[model samples]
Each structure stands twice: as structure tokens, then as C-alpha cells.
Target: MDNASAITVFTLSGLNGTEKYRIPLFVVTFLCYSLIWVANVIIIVTIIMDKNLHEPMYILLCNLCISGLFGTAGFYPKFLSDLLSSTHVISFPGCLLQGFVVHAYIGVDFSILLIMSLDRYVAICRPLVYHSVMTRQRVGLLVLYAWLLPATLVMVGSITTFILKLCDSHIPRLYCINYFVNKLACTASVANFIIPACTYTIYVCHFVIIFWSYFYLIRTCRQSKEKMSKFMQTCLPHLFCLKILGVSLLFDLMYIRFGSVDLPQGLQNFIAIEFLVVPPILNPVIYGMKLTQVRNRIAQLFGKRDPMPHKAEFLMVEFESSCPNPPQDPFEGTQHRHEGVSLNQDIIQAFSAAACLASGSRHGLIRLGGASSGSHTLFRHGEAVFKLKQQVSELLLF
Candidate 1:
């Protein structure tokens, strides 16, 4: 089918004729839709307020929440309108617009997920370089690409679908997605099937690469005990999210290529909620609860701080006549040590003695060791008591 014969509008056969089902369906759909929206909103607000969540993982999560909002917003309003109003009709342009926005956001969401996986891979795989590689500036640029690239792709796909002529007017689902909506068109090109298939394949390949990167990251982290525990804590939530998204995609693939099995649809629809909603909801919880920095911020936000233990302090009293050159066994020697002092004790005695010795004044040159080879001289300004300690120490030796 060429561009001229393509059908612009599609008539949805989903609960359109039922008078009794409309109000109940509206309430149920409205609640589900509202739940997704409210949950996403909470995540976005939490990320913005929590200083601990300023990192790339949390930023990616915020983006995903925004994308999910766009997805739900694009699909539900029109769905609500169709359900409530006497007219179940959508103009060709309106239907096309809806399709574009929905697919575009889905694409953007996928790209953001890829970026998140890469963020985790770098954090675990290259710990030293992770900050340099995924800095704020670099993250901002990646996010721009995540949104923009999908928008371009959406334009191409939406145009292709809009231009194809429809043989029948009835669209099967409550929502107009790519496959079912496209099936209504009269022009079924290998291009139509091939292009979408290739697009999905590209996304699938992206998903595969992220998992492969994470696999290597996990393997590398296991070699070191310190990093191993932190690595598991950091990567677990992302792994769960990836699993949910994988199942959603799997069902989508099967639904499109194979015959529409009842099992796949049920699983797909259920997993779809997880794919879009769970990541956003879990992101703040995981990052906020597990990380020290985030927890500190949370405390700070609540105007609280952890109590610090008091430390006991004392003075050092013993000293040696001859100061050793190498300071023998600093930790073990007790000759110049305050044996009973706790580690936190301040070295007050030495400072006090030095202060007292430097307080008075004098001015003279004094020699020690009786001018022998080892003799040392001390200069006192008519009253530079700072040199008194040296003179007194030399006299003590003599």
C-alpha cells in the first residue's frame, strides 16, 4: 500500500458498545492509571529532594519515571474519553498522534534503561574510572540522546503506519499499539514488518549487551571481598528491573511474531506494569536505604544526626634522656609513653612543657659537651626563652 491509500483513523472495537461496562471499566482503568501516575510522581519528587540520589543511577530512575508518565499520559486520557463519551471515535490525526507519542516514550524508556545498565557496568567494572567516565556532564549528554533518538525513531515509525491503508476499521485492543493498529492497514509491506522487527531487534541487542556487560562486572567484583558486597547491593535492583523488562519484551515478541497466545498476553500485560512502574518505585527505596551517603542526607533532611560517642583524653609524662634517631618501636615502646591513656587522649603534657619553656626570655650563647666533637650551641636572644629547653636538656646530659 502506497502513502495515498493509507487509512488515518481506526475504529476500536474494545468495549465500545457496552453501556453497563463503561462506568465500572472507567473506575478500574482510572485507578490503575492513577496509581501509575501517582507512584511515578512520588519517585520524581523523592529523587529531586534527596541529595543522596543525585548519582547517575537515581538520575536514570528519574528519567524512567518521567518516561512512564509520558507513556501513561499518552494512552489513558484518550482511553478515558472513549470510555465515557457517547462518541467512541478518534480522528485519524488524533489516533496517529497518540501512536507516535506512546511509541516514542517507549523507545526513550528503553534507551534510558540501556544507559542505566552501562552506568552500573562502569561502576562495578571500572571502579577507579567510574566517576571520571560517568560524570555529571557526560550523564547529561547521554540523557539528551536517550530522549532525542527515540523521538526521531518515533517520527519514522508513526509516519510509516499512518501512511498505510486500512482494510478494516476495527482495532482489537483498548489501546492502539503498533502491531494491532498496523495490522488494520491495507498496505502490508515486508518493509512494515521488516522495519519494526529490525527496530525491536536493535532494542533487544541493546538489552543483551547491557546484561553481558553486567555479567562481566559481577565476575570482576567477585575477585575482591570488599567490592563484592557493595557490588551485590548496588546491582541487585537493576538486575531485578532488567528481568522484569526482559519478560515484558519476550511476551511482546511472541505476541507479534507467533500467534496471540492467551498466556503471553496475560503475562505481558502484568509484566508491563512492572517494567514501567516497579523500577521508579524501588529506585528511591534501594538507593535511599542502602547507601550511607543517602541515609545521611535523609537524616539531615529530617533535621537529625547520629549521636557521636565521647572520647577520653589524657597527657604523656615519661621521657628519655637521649632522643633516639629512628624513634624505636613507636607503637610498642613505653619509656616516653603514657601507658594508661586511651588512644583518643590528647598529647597535652608535651605541649604544656614546651609552652612553659618558651615563655621566659634570655640572650646568650651557651655550649654543651664542653666544646667536644659532639658539642652543640644554643642562642638565646637577651630573652629568647624558646632556647632554654635546649640549654637545660644539654646541661641535664652533662
Candidate 2:
């Protein structure tokens, strides 16, 4: 039997037809990699900085984004370099390491999504005990378990493949996968079959948990509008993410196990790489757009940091100024008329100054009702104040 040590490198055949479009492919790959980093980093940072976002769902989401970054780092850099190279080969240790990272990435993704589903279930289905069930300590443990379990499983799988004697050193896909490495073994060990089968079965249970959580979530939400609204806003993004990952994984698994040579090489390649490309890009975009808190936090990160007072603040000031009541109708008597005009002027000046600051401009004062001759001027000032107030309100909302 030829020993595993004999094969120090494996040639990847996935780059077979990439020569004609290598440059274009490299450019696109580089851009996609950059985007994945930017998007994932933004989410991670947004979650980390905001104390309000330190909840279970957001924490799981942060880990999920980190997993995307981890998984892509395993593929894109090497793939980018391979695109520009003549020989597409990876050293044995490098191959094993890549397989470990890619596999761990996928496993962690499933784990985090599962945890997220459980989180949603608790938050929506069992709201009263969510805090007790998913406390800070427990959430930390869950996240740790999510990452650690996958890393341990993949590590064992990589080690199992590492010990095998190989008769061939060719990998059909663009990157190293443990299954492909196992295929290269001189003889299939029962452990190889059993371990992966068990791993798949375990993750299938995860899928079941996800589906079950969502089932109850859907059922519970239907009875109440508030729960239904929460489900649509938060749970939908998770479902979309799960669907995207599931489809990509299904294509890769199907093609790897039962794919025929009759299929086009391009289509085969696309199927193989879909999981690596789509999920990393799509997860952040979906969550950033769909989750209101995440969206607002992201906006706040890129937006200016001036604090705008709330609507209640404006109302409070109005309340305080009007507290000292005078006549029922100030304009009814000439004696109290000057005081009313002065009070009105003070209110207008204060609001105008606030509006100017909120608008980041200082042009003119917003005049109140003065004379019929200047009614047009007052109308114009009123319009500007209305627009300024709207802008301030929008800023405060974010």
C-alpha cells in the first residue's frame, strides 16, 4: 500500500476551463472577497459597539457573520492566487487545513443558525423566560459551543483523512474538501464512512430543530398581530439565510455524490462553488436590510453623531413655556398683548435655532404671524420650519 506521506501535493482540476476568463474571474473574485469583509465587519462592529444589541439573537448573528468571514478566508485568498497561477496545486498540509476551515465554517454556520432559531423560539414562543433561558452566561456558552463543536468535528474529520493512504492525488473541485480527500484514499475505512454519516445525521437533527422552531413560531405568531410582526421582521431574515445556505449546500452535496460527467463543466463548477460565494454575500445584506435594529445601527455608524432631542423634548419645552397662564385670550386685552407677542417670539426663536442646528444650517429666523403685509414671508418661514422639523424627526428616528 502506498503511504499517505508519498503524496505531498494534490492537483485541483476545477480550474480546467478558467484560462479564457481568468482575469475577469480574478477581478470579480477580488471584489466579492472585499465586499464580504466589509459587510461582515460592519455587522460585527455594529453589534459589538451597541449595548442594546448584545442580546442572544444579535450575538448569534455576529458569530454567523464571523463564520462567513472565516470560511471565505479559507477559499478566496487561495482561489484568487490560483486564478493567476499556471499550476493549480495545494500542498498536503495546506489541503488538510483548507478542508478543516471550509468544513468547520459550514458546520459553524449550521450551528449558529440553529442557535438563532432556538433564540427566536424562546423570544417569540416563550417570551417571559427568554431572559432566564438565554442569559449572558448561557448565550456565551451557546456561542462557544456552536463554534467549538464544529471545529472539533472538522478537526477529527481532517485528522482521519490525514492518516489515510492515498492512491491518487487529484481533487476535482476548486478547493480542498474532506470528502474529496477521503475519496482519494487507497481503501475506504469503516471509520471514514461512519464518522461523516454520523456528522450528517447530527446536522440533520439541527435542520429538524430549525424547522420545528419555525413551525411553532409560525403557529404562535398567527394568533397575535404583535408576534406576527416580530416574526416577519426578525425570523424572516433567518429563514431566508437558512434557505440560501440549504440550497447551496444541497447543490454541492448532490453534485459531489451523484453528479454525472454529462453535465457541463461550467454548471458543475457553479454548483460546487455556490455555497462558498452566495451565503457570505447574502447573509449580511439580508440582515442589514431586514432587521430594523441592525439597519438603524449601521446607519448610525455611517451617519453623523449629533444628538437630536426627541419629540417629547420639544413638547416639554412647549409645556413649560405655556405653564404661566394669563388671560383666556391674550389678544382680548391690549394690556397683556405685548407679553403674548414676546412669548411667541421667544418660542419661534428657540425652535428656529434648534431647526438650524438639526439642519446643519444657519440662514434665517423662522418668523411667526406678524403683519398681513409680510404674510408671504411668514408662509415661507413656516414652510422652511416644517421641512426642518421633518428632517430632525427623521434623524431622531434613526
Candidate 3:
């Protein structure tokens, strides 16, 4: 294309050397995209359905997963289509839209991570006032800003790219990025450089805030065992997520800006697409396993019940055997009162045995069970057992 005004469609040159591997790549990409959708959807649904998980941490996690879904949607579907087609092309407007979505997705991720760090800082450092500080209204506003800020900034960047006069209509990547798109322009504009620089500066501030929060978190945790445990349980997962995303993004940025033909084609492709491949799938898996409540809720959702002791079952069986029939009125006759007392003693003995068994203490089981058994035997044949039965029935009524 001679000029941006004359360009209607842009040809993608990223797939030029990978034609032989397209089928295998298509299969792998399909599986990856499927996994991203399923994992993120599972987390989003789990958080929404479980009211007990409606705290700031889980709410932020849901937003993160939603961002993953949003970001991956921009690349995967179109990339899959390109894999099967001989000609890889996108319209001028389509490329701009894809660029906007992809960039906005990245911006939303950084923004959400920033908010999450702030939440953790307030929760761990200002625990006493966490509730007052992270109210429902405030979290809602923060989430709204997380999405809106990125969309607005990225939109401006996309518009700047859209107006640039281009000398080429060939993009070397499987997907669109504003940075890559700007490189095709015939002439550099001040707005192009200035807007992207400002965007990077804003996200760099996000990184600084995240690291600053972590520093305080580390210091607070070192002073107390309880705080340390909380930090490990919660903050470690966030840190892991930040590390994966940061490294992936770094690889992509470096590869796009300074990649060389000397590097292996496969290696360059891997570096270029690492961000889209790793974070979407890994984030949900990491959070699902590390967050105790989320893990337990997931287990419960899939009908995996916690293990119960066999001893409790044994105790129930013994109690049922001893009390074959429901108790009759103890006041009806002398024989009835005697039988009721005997049954009541067996029930108490059974309960005491179960308690000892559940505790899994051999010493306590021997002592408590032996005492209860002997006491039941002594009371079973005693003349005063009927009077004890009357008192027990009155207690049960009360």
C-alpha cells in the first residue's frame, strides 16, 4: 500500500514459516483456548454463586478471570481462523479493533493487579479498619475504574494509530498490536510516540504501587507469625501471578521491538505469543489451588465431600443396636420405668464412647469408655435407676 488511505486489508506475514506445523498448531491452540474459557468460567461462577466468597479478595479474583477471558477473546478465535486459511488478512478497521481489544486487555490486567495490591495492603497493614476501608461501594468503583481507564487510554492509542499514513499493509505477527501497527506508518507522528509513552508511564506507576505494597506486606508479615501465614496464603498467589504476567509481557515487548532474524523462528514465535498462552490458563490454576476457600468450594461443587471417621459410624451402629425400639412412657408401669432407665444408660455410654473414639486418643478412650461401661452396668441393676430415669426425662423435656 502506498498510503494508509488506500489500504483496505493488511496481510499477516507471521505464519509464513510455520505452514507445515499448522495442523498441530491448530490442535494445540484449540485446546489452549478451550482451557482458558473453561478455567476462567469455573472461577467466575464459583465466586458468584458462593455468598461466603463475596469478600474483596474473591471479587477481585473474579475480575481478573474476567479480564483473562476478555483478553484471550481478541486473539484466539482470529488466530485459529488464520491457521486454516491460505491467505492471512484482516481489514484495516478490523486490525484497529483487534489492536484496541488486545491493548485494552493488557491495561485492564495491570489496573486490576494494582487494585488487588491496594486491597491486600489495606487488609494486611490496616486490618483493624479493613472493613471500613474496603467497603462494597469502594470496591465497585475501583473495579469500574480498572476497566474504564484502560479502555479509554487504549482507545486513544488505537485512534492515533488509525490516522497514521502507512507505507506497508503487511503485519509480521499472527495478531495485531498498536505498537506493531505504528511501525508500518510512512511517517512518525508526535501523538503516536507521546500517547504510548504516557500509557507506559501510567502502567509503570502501577508496577511501582504493586511493589511498594508488597514491601509493606513483607515487613508486616515478618513481625508476626499470624500475619506471615496470611501473607503466604494470599499474597504469594498474587505475586506468582504478577511474576508470570510480567515475564510474559517482557518477552513479548522485547521480541516485538528488537527481535532478530538470527534467532530461531520457533523461538521468536514462542516469545511473541507467550503472554496470550501462559497467563490465561495459569492464573486460574494457581489461584484455584492456592486459595483455600476457592479450592474447597471447587471440591464441594464437584461433589467431593470431606472424609468422615469410621469410628463415628461404628458408634451410631452400636447406639442403634442398643435402642432397637423407641422409648415407651416411663410413668406407665414399674417394668416400663426400669426398661427406660436401662436404655438411657446405654445411650449415654454409646455417646461417651463415640466422643472418645472421635478424638483418636487411645488413653482417653480406655478411661472414659471403661468408666461409662462400668457405671452403666452398676446403674442397670440398681433400685435407684428408676428415679434417675425420671430426672433424665424431665431434663430432656426442659
Clashing residue pair totals per candidate (backbone < 3 A): 11, 0, 0
TM-score of each: 0.66, 0.77, 0.76
Tens digit per residue, CA lDDT, model 2, 1-398: 64565899999998897799999999999998999999999999999998767778888999999999999999999999999999999999999999989999999999999999998898777764566788899999999999999998888888888889998899988999988988888888888998898899999999999999999989999997856876888899999999999999998898788889788888988898898889999999999998766877787799944253222112211111121222232222121111122223434443544344234323233333222122212212235555434433322221
Better of 1 and 3 by TM-score: 3
- Against the reference, the lDDT scores of all candidates come to 0.60, 0.76, 0.74
Could you arrange the candidates by TM-score from highest to lowest?
A: 2, 3, 1
- Locate the minimum summed-lDDT window of 10 residues in model 1: 308-317
Candidate 3 off by > 4 Å:
1-3, 307-398
lDDT of 1 by residue, 307-332 (tens): 42111111223322221222232322
lDDT (10s digit) by residue, model 3, range 293-347: 6887788889985353111011111211122222432221112111223333544
Q: What is the Cα root-mean-square deviation between model 1 and the actual structure?
A: 15.8
Candidate 3 displacement at residue 370 in angstroms: 31
Q: Any runs in candidate 1 off by more than 4 Å, and if so which? A: 1-8, 16-21, 50-52, 261-398
